[model samples]
Target: MIRFIITRLLNGVVLLFAVATIAFFLLYWGAGDIARQILGASASQETVDLKAEQLGLNEPVFSRYGEWLSNAIHGDLGASWFTNQPVTEAITSRMGVTLSIVIGTVILTAIVATILGVSAARYGGWRDRTLQVVSILGLAIPGFLIAIFLVRIFAIELGWLNATGYIDFTDSFTGWLKSVTLPIIALSIGAMAAVAQQVRGAVKDAMRQDWVRTLRSRGISENRVVYKHVLRNASGPALAILALQFVGLLGGAVIVEKVFAIPGIGQISVTATTQGDLPIVMGIVVFTAALVVVINLSIDLLLGFVNPKVRLS
Candidate 1:
């Protein structure tokens, strides 16, 4: 287990390094005279040059990348080029809100997907076919459109929830719940559809295995055999899908944040990208890459712990 974990961590580190390298160079080469853009066209040549120097744009691109990467290794992500706010600080401030939504979506998806999947597998009738149809539709529709529908129905028409804006949990727990509920649901629908299908397939496959019959023959109760042995075997794959869903949610959260008016990492990401705020943008890129690595590592570790073959390998 220890060896497995260590190997996974090393792999994650390599992946993070690769992502940071690509993100850094792409932002650097593609951005095109950020200082000039910041200073505007009317600014004189000398002033533009000074602005470039101040922003470190005049430095060799490779040298700047080296400095940035080195500082990042030492836990110094630098400051926002526009606001001059520390990159880490800026991200952390809104990180919680984004995480809260994503986490809620995960939990909701897990519970609902499990129920639907297990049921569809067990019943295997009209319910199974019906679920397949709905799941396909759920997967096909974009998350933002669903969010908009939710906003129109729940927030505007019914006035049951807030259409836009965020509330801090510290300020009011109820308000915060109301604020995040729609976003979480919007994200969860697609995930639920996808995961439920995986779970259903896994469960059905497990039920068909000879081990299930062997257990039943040995006098194990039906429910116990199905829930304990069958579900356990089914869990491994569903868990992997869940991790992938987490990554998807992060991407989707950007649009969800804008539609819902939540000041999360996603919101800041949009603003930073629009303004060519490279420090903030780079910081976010690194943060996202790190987030993905950590989540994937955790899942791999979980799988290793759950399955002896994986750990032994």
Candidate 2:
């Protein structure tokens, strides 16, 4: 297990480096003159040239990339070209908001999806059909549309939540919940639907396995056999699917944050990208990649723990 973990972590580091390299070059070469964009069309040619020189845009792309990569390795992400703020500071400040939504939504998704899935599999009639239809609808509907509908019903019509605002958890827990509830729901529904269907299939397959029948033959209670043996064996695939959805939720948060006016990494990422702020944009990209790598590695480790066969690979 320790060897497996170390191997995964090493791979994650290499993956992050590749992501950083690709992101830096793409933004540097593809996005035309940052200095000109910052100064605008009205700025004189000489002024733009001087500004570019100041930003070291005059330096070779490889040279600048080397400096950025070296500094990043030493924990200096560099100051934003546009805001002049440290990239790390800007991202860390908004991390809380994004983390809150992502974590809350993941937990909610797992609980709801698991229950609905297991129930549908156990019953296997009208209840299962209803859940399947709902899951299909969830897959069909985009998250942004769900956000808009939620805002209209829960915020505007019912007045149960604020249509657009974020409350710091440090200020008040209740206020924070009120602020984030709609966004979480909007994000969770799609993930829940996907996981539920996958889980339902996994559970049904596990129950049909010879091992389950053998356990039942040993005089094990039906509930004990299903919960302890069937679900446990079935959980591996469901967990893998859930981990992927959690990553997807991070991307979806970008739209949800924009709709709700929440100041999160996603919102700032859009701002930085639009302004051609290389340092900040790179920071966001690398951070997002790191998040994905870590989540996947954690899931791998968890699966290895739950099913020893995974560690062999």
Winner by lDDT: 1
Off by over 4 Å in 2: 308-313
Residue-level lDDT of model 2, residues 114-206, one tens digit each, is: 999999998899989999999999989999999999999999999999899899999999899999999999999999999999889999998
Assess each prediction's global lDDT (C-alpha) against the native. 0.91, 0.91
TM of each candidate vs. truth? 0.96, 0.96
lDDT assessment of candidate 1 = 0.91
Q: Estimate the Cα RMSD of every predicted model relative to the unseen true structure.
A: 1.5, 1.5
Residue pairs with clashing backbones, model 1: none
TM-score, structure 2 vs. true: 0.96
Candidate 1 similarity to native, TM-score: 0.96
Total colliding residue pairs, candidate 1: 0
Q: Report the poorest 10 consecutive residues by lDDT, candidate 1.
A: 304-313
lDDT of 1 at 33: 81
